[model samples]
Target: MNQNEAVQQNSKPRRVSKKKGKALNNPPVKRLLLPTVVYLIIATQIPFIVTIYYSFQEWNLMRPDKGVTFTWFTNFIKALSAPSFYEVAMNTLILTTSVLMICFVCGLLLALLMNRNFVGKGIVRTMFISPFFVMPTVSGIIWKTMVYNPSFGFSAYFANVFGVAPYDWFTQNPLLAVIFIISWMWIPFFMLILLAGLQSLPMELIEAAQLDGANRLQQFFNVTIPHLVRYIEVVVLLGLMFILQVFGEIYVTTSGGPGFASTNLSFLVYRTGFQSWDVGGASAIGVITVILTIVMMLLMFKVLRRMFKEEQA
Candidate 1:
């Protein structure tokens, strides 16, 4: 019996190893993935390579005579030194952070509310998620015209009803307006992710907490939040990536506005390349934006990891 058991254990490892080897050496899988890999390289990497090349050159479309000379870091220096660049960078940071916080909080609340059994829940969820389906440009236009138009829109109607002044959202508070619109649009996305997380949470854990004399808030903080950490990380990271590149709304609403107040890095890149015709500068900014994105994502991962470890401990 002992020898039979030993033989079975030895054969099991061999079988597992063989499976792993086959998976690793699978020609069919490699063949299937080859086209996708090549397409990704052609579609993404080639443009990035071209952008890097342009960043080292002094290319201004307006100055055709000067014609793309390799200036090597001049564009980087100018991009870093420009006063408007700092404002745009700050705006980008503020917008990304504000939207994330708002979305996270609102989404969590909504998720919690929706997680409970209720009538019309499906319709409510569908309505909540509907905004996410709207195009960014359409969202911007809707808010700009129907909601925020101080003269004849919803704001005006509300202000008149309350006998108060209609505030010019885009004009007086362009960055805040952009933040609000973005948060409104993204909250549903965050809610969807968090709802999935909430639903997947083990009911036994909640029951255990309750039996241990834990109150609702205590259970929520000690149990629910910890369980949702991964979902939160996913929501935050994805939101950060998309929010950092938000341009359509900004373009439609403020157009980077009364002097770069609403200009993010993405909008700045467009403004530099298309409007200002500074191709080199735009390329440099684009590279910098990519670096910033990677660093921020790394830092977020580190912070979340530490939090998760502490929770486990």
Candidate 2:
């Protein structure tokens, strides 16, 4: 009996080792993973390769007889040097920054408000979330037609009540109009993330803070803000990424301008490729935008990593 027990103990390690070996060399997992990886590579690489190839060649759809000529860095140089590019870049920055700031503040406030138990809380939360579920094109149209239209719209109706003339929002402040529409749509998304973070806070910590004579504002600044740093980082980075590619709202509402007043980098790319028929230049712009986005993400990741390390330390 003692010899049999010794053999059983000895066999356990061997069995575990065999299982580990099988896990490492699992045929089914390898088969599944290999095709998924190949599919991703093909899907991403094909468009990227095509875009890079086109960026160095001059190709105008309107003048196909001219033929595609290799211009090397000419398209990139032209896109960078164009005066309108600066305006569009600046507009993009302004729109993204404005929307992020407004949405973050409003979303945080709403999240804090909703964290408390209140009557009709479910209904209010549902209403808040509804805007985010609306299609972007439909949202843009609704804002343009129902809210911002100078004539026979909500703005005009409100103006009559207040004894003021109706203002054409898109014409006078196209960027602001677009920003407002986007912020309204995205605030709910931010709120949901922030509310989840708020809900996850340990009640003991909050109660302890209150017992230590921390008022609501002090507790918020001292306790709440520290706990939410990671969540805030997520919201900002993802929000910036999506906002940089804002096109539908601009396309539907402003069409990049009365005169390039609201044109962002994405909209500029669209206009260059389709409207100007300069595929090479548009491709160059597209590549540059992708590179810039990658650089920004890298910087953000590095900063966040350092912050996390410091916190851990």
Q: Would you estimate the TM-scores of all the predictions?
A: 0.88, 0.88
lDDT of each: 0.91, 0.89
Query: Which residues of candidate 1, in runs, are more than 4 Å off?
Result: 1-27, 301-313
TM-score for candidate 2, please give it.
0.88
Off by over 4 Å in 2: 1-29, 303-313
Write candidate 1's Cα lDDT for 118-138 as tens digits.
999999999999889899999
Give the least accurate 10-residue stretch of model 2, judged by summed lDDT: 18-27
Error of 1 at 159 (Å): 1.5
Instruction: Give the C-alpha miss distance for residue 114 in model 1, angstroms.
Output: 0.7
Tell me the tens digit of each residue's lDDT in model 2 across 117-192: 9899999999998988888888999999999988877998999899998988999999999999999999998998
Question: Can you give the lDDT of residue 196 in candidate 2?
Answer: 88
> Native-vs-model 2 lDDT?
0.89
